[model samples]
Target: MRCDQVRQTLEESGEAYPAPVLHHLRHCPECAAYEHHWRWVRAGLLALARETAPEPSLGFARRLIRRLEEGFLPMRLVGEFFETAGRRVVYFTLLLATVLLLAIALPSSGPLRGRPARDVSWPQPEIVATRDYPIPPSELPGAGFSLTSESDVSGGQK
Candidate 1:
């Protein structure tokens, strides 16, 4: 059998080595070394399991519980609230202040506000009395046009 198969069998069988695994370990020095390492690990683990764990001092559990309870004071609850919701409140306040600052810093005559009334007056056209062309006033470009009836422009058609 292959070294991997033999090692897998040895691991699965725990302390019991099958005939094939024993034969493989006897021939393969690499597998024998692997088995030796695992034996040492198992022995150490068994020794740990057999040894007794150290006991805590008297009132250790009570002291730990008392300390845990003391940690949950009203001030601690307030601190937890500040840790969570306080950040959001501060951010919202900062955002509102920023918006207010922008509103105050911006010009009052922005597009949102109505345009200011301009005190500008258009220049009146001056009439020239030059004798260059003696054209009649009735023959002016816009003189023939008036607010006439629509029927007059439509050839009197109804």
Candidate 2:
């Protein structure tokens, strides 16, 4: 390990003998020296006291309220309101509108919702079977023949 890494480990762990890294350091003279020096230097780094922080001002609350009243919230914090409000309204409105539009536009094909249609059955036309009048070759027009009125057949002869 480098000198700085050993120093950091010594400072963070605050131990004379590091079981994990000491094995690697003992084999390496540079690292072992770094660990030895860091252990001594760690004394200075560990000298910090809980009393070092300055006392809070008596008027801290009053000052904080004044700052709040002045609309001095951080830019990122100020943006949170607009961001959350826009997301709620836009997403909610879009979903609501989509649901309403779909309800109005879609076909309700269920038996209860759909209207009943008139019964209709389109059947294939059949060849007229009659023993009295035999179908002649001349009477055949096409694949599906349309029969003329009986009066028309007789009127043409008259």
Candidate 3:
């Protein structure tokens, strides 16, 4: 077996060396050194496990829980609001007020206000009634010639 496989077996088995691992450890000096180092580390960890851990001062947990339950005061909550979102809201309001003030203060002739109106007058179209033109003699039906007015064509009383 490889040195890595032997070391892995030693780490996995923990104090119980398999037959193949024992054979490898006897042959590989580096693996034997690694196994020795791990043994010392395991002994130290075991010693630490046997000793009692340090305890917190009495009422520490109760005080912490009470503080969490009590929550923040209204003024402190307001202060926190100002520290975060309130400041941004104030800045945005100030910016909007400044833009509105500039729009009101500046003259209409300003570049951002757009182009001024020009004095342009288009020619008026001439309106000609159909009755204004005399009918051609050749276009009239045989033996009868009539000129109709706007009222006659529109079914109005003649």
Candidate 4:
């Protein structure tokens, strides 16, 4: 087997070498040296783990508890507020009222706030002008234009 593969297997299994790797290590000096080095490294790590374990600084637990409590306080307050049916109903009512007010006020405020001012005066010819254009008789056929009553359109009912 390759030295890297044997090394990975040794590192992972930590004392469980397969028969092929054991035979290969016996025949290969480079792989045997690597196995010896890895064994020494593992022994050192075990000794380190057996020695003094790490301890947190003073008040570390208390500070962590305080931070967690502070972070959750607002969420807890909101949860309590929603837990009561009255508060939940009141909150939804206010929200709905606000949405309704905005819906009504925004559209109606358009004429007051968004529209341009009356630039044309009351007697302005442009505003008062008729949209109609009377067609001249010359434009009509020899079945000339006439009206007997408002209903008699053919222009002349021929």
Candidate 5:
């Protein structure tokens, strides 16, 4: 058998070589060296897997559990609600509904409110005219029309 066939057999069987592959290994020095190297690698990996992993100290799990249980309940609820897609969508929908209700319920108080806002008269009326008096001199400069009261200007002295 070829070296490749022997190598394939060695990898497939893990530490056990078939009798025919072993006969091939006895004749081929290169295949024998390769098999020995792969066997050492497998043994090292097996030993590493069997080694003990590190563990936390005695009360770590208890302390962590107690801390979680005693922490803020509202914050924990919010955290859990945001942890998944469906929960987050529900939370967002609830939040949107709350905002929408508040918007509808609260009375709006600004110039943009429901009732049409009355336009504020600019430059107050008194500045333009008095009850029945002539317009201000500063306002009407040269319209030559003069208002004469029947008591004063019917027949002028000057």
Candidate 6:
């Protein structure tokens, strides 16, 4: 069997796999050799002491902690949120415009309460009725109509 096939079986629990996999490993020379080396390396790592430590350069931990603390302030977080949200606000404004257009295009069955509603003129008199000011066909001396008194024209009628 190939090392890939054997490595997969080694990674999974034996109870989750078929028994023939283990039997094949025992008979396959290459798989048996790979499994033997893998077990030896795993044992070496497990046998190490728990207290083993790696040495650190001077001020490395303190400088890393300082960098993390300086970069994660609340103001920086709020600024980043606005930067990410600005595009969404533009899209929301576009959606609101579309909604307004549709609202105007569709008619409603209520009082015209919306702004810029249609303006209707009041029911004014169409046919003016004035009597006794007789109309004349010709400006004759003795006529069907005549002015009783001469009135000045400037601001005169009122």
Candidate models: Cα lDDT each: 0.77, 0.69, 0.78, 0.73, 0.76, 0.65
**Higher lDDT: candidate 2 or 6?**
2
Query: On residues 29-125, what C-alpha lDDT tens digit does candidate 4 reach at each position?
Result: 9888988998999999999889986799999889879978887566677787768977879999999999888777785435545654564336655
Q: Write the per-residue lDDT of candidate 3 for residues 48-153, one digit (tens) a residue.
A: 9999988998998998788778973567777898788978998999999999999899988647876555424444334322445554444555655557655565
| Candidate 5 vs 6: which has more TM-score | 5
Candidate 6 local lDDT, 60-126, one digit each (tens)? 8998789788885567788988988998999999999999997897767334555443445444333
Error of 3 at 127 (Å): 55
Residue pairs whose backbone atoms clash in candidate 6: none
Better of 4 and 5 by lDDT: 5
Error of 3 at 68 (Å): 0.4
What lDDT would candidate 3 get against the real structure?
0.78
Error of 3 at 21 (Å): 0.3
The sequence of per-residue lDDT tens digits that candidate 1 reaches over residues 21-71 is: 998898899999999999999889989999998999999899879978888
How do the candidates rank by TM-score, highest first?
3, 1, 4, 5, 2, 6
Worst window of 10 by summed lDDT in candidate 4: 127-136
Candidate 6 structure, TM-score to reference: 0.29
lDDT of 6 at 60: 85
Whichever of 2 and 3 has more TM-score, that candidate is 3
Model 1: clashing residue pairs? Answer: none
Q: Give the runs in model 2 whose Cα sits over 4 Å from its true position.
A: 1-12, 16-27, 49-51, 72-158
Q: How would the candidate models be sorted by lDDT, starting from the highest?
A: 3, 1, 5, 4, 2, 6
lDDT per residue, candidate 2, 1-158, as tens digits?
66566657766775765775776676778777877786676566667542387878999999989988997887887699889998999999999999999889877655545653532344424534342453443465475554765566666556
* Per-residue lDDT of 3 in model 6: 59
The alpha-carbon deviation from the true structure for residue 143 of candidate 2, after best TM-score superposition, in angstroms, is 42
**Global local distance difference test of model 1:** 0.77
lDDT of 4: 0.73
Cα miss at 27, model 4 (Å)?
0.8
Best by TM-score: 3
